[model samples]
Target: MTQPRVAKDWYESAGVRSGPRRMLEEDREFGLEVFPERLVPHLAHEGLADLGAEGRRALLTQHFYQYMLFTSHLETKVVNRGAALVAHGEVDIEVGPEARLDAFKIYSDEAYHALFSLDVVQQVEKVTATPVLPYDFGPRMARLDRTVERFLPDHGALGHLLQVVAFETVVTRFLAQIPRDEKVFRVVREVVGDHVRDEVHHHAYFSRFFKELWAGLPPRTRSEVACSMPHFVNDCLRPDLGPVRAALLSVGVPADRAEEVIRDCYREEMLVAGVRDAGRHTLALCETVGAFDFPEAREQLQLLGLAD
Candidate 1:
């Protein structure tokens, strides 16, 4: 069994090294705005963009809330679940002590991340006086749940492991991109910047984990998991427009017009482009194990606009 290249000196280098983050009261007043306008691309729609300063701020705040909520849930529910499975030896994959120890560290980082993410969400709510709009576990996780349901009664754990593998191995662009825009609120950028630093090590750990997991699977099981890769990529990267539509309506756009705005901004081509750009790392990792070699998997990828 190939041992995953565990992150070195995690006690010194990990985000958890500093302990949990808190949103200082002054952070709310530090930036002119609460969230970056660029982070919410739907605002670029002429109809939506014209929503003036106040309207735009309302929308950006809601978008920011949804982002933090999404991050919190993903860390606690999905990533941590995967890490726990490996750390506790619940998974079938055989790994070295180094990998298991790193899994524990990953688990800690994810929990700390979730804590800080929720901290910001609550602080933003108090600062903006805008309660987070009601949402499910987030569209991406909801989609993953539905996909995992198909393998119920037997392969559920395998399905879940693959989903985590697909998600963790990717070099997530948003993690870095969110902090790059200095115009974004200082707190938002700082929190995400911390996450970005941790995920760099996570990306390396999971890449090696995937190689080990793939090497040990039987051919039939490999094909079964491979068949789901395209859909997994699609589920993971496709932008969820529900929150955008809600944010638009909250900003006083009429119901019908909000739908139109979402349709225009989140067009089919734009969705495909997002997946192509964000899913590249995951798709490439899958290809490393020939996940696309199966005709069924290849067809699925092509149909999802991930391939010709």
Candidate 2:
């Protein structure tokens, strides 16, 4: 027997012209140029203010090396999965044409994000002496592996949808908060812009999927998952500021000062705004799916310092 043909549409399955594509074009046209002239001095000044001069330089070096590795690893995984999905077009098998188009747009965005991350890695290596280590999120990856084993197998399609929705929501939240003034921030923002654009579609696609899943779940199971969501969100929001901090401390900044700097960076109003937007988006998703009340999610938001 032959496999069934999947439906394609001009806007959905035809190509990658969408929000992400527009953002990429905007970046190419208007994006700030990052280089040693602006970047090195910015790092030096910021580091000096936060950690003493030495600590500042050290943290910059650490960040240069560590972020390259970390983002590279993350982008690689995202690209592989996104490429596979796009190539196979299997995810849209059950969904409507609109959803498939949205998913395709997301896949294209992921590809761009992955390529942008790789480009940043190369750029950092060219300008800095920091050595790239053969390491990344060792403990976290192990934990995710175990969690996937425990949760992914039993949740069926619904479980998978929930996980994807939650993760994409959180990632979009983070990408939207990145600072834009610093050279590093600019580079990071460009890469993340792609992710943010793509994630909007992913969130939409999963919202529909979550609704279907939620309607079918037994009340007891629904309650169990709802209760667990706060902890899950907390774990996801735990910022890995270690690399940033280590970089500062390496340059001779006192540990206390480094901590203060990290806190200040995260405490910016823009970061808070991003958190609020993300929380609202997640709450909206919850409303759509009829999973749990906003009050329950608000508690989680408070735990993450995203709400009062």
lDDT against the true structure, each candidate: 0.78, 0.48
Per-residue lDDT of candidate 2, residues 37-96 (tens digit): 232223634535544544444445555556446655544453335434534444323454
Off by over 4 Å in 2: 1-61, 64-72, 75-105, 133-135, 142-153, 156-160, 171-189, 252-278, 293-308
Span of ten consecutive residues with least summed lDDT in model 2: 1-10
Give the number of the best model, judged by TM-score: 1
| Cα TM-score per model | 0.92, 0.59
How big is the positional error of residue 41 in model 2, measured in Å on the Cα after superposition? 18
Question: What's the lDDT for residue 295 in model 1?
Answer: 83
Per-residue error at 222 for model 1, in Å?
0.8
lDDT for model 2 comes to: 0.48
Candidate 1: RMSD over Cα atoms?
A: 2.1
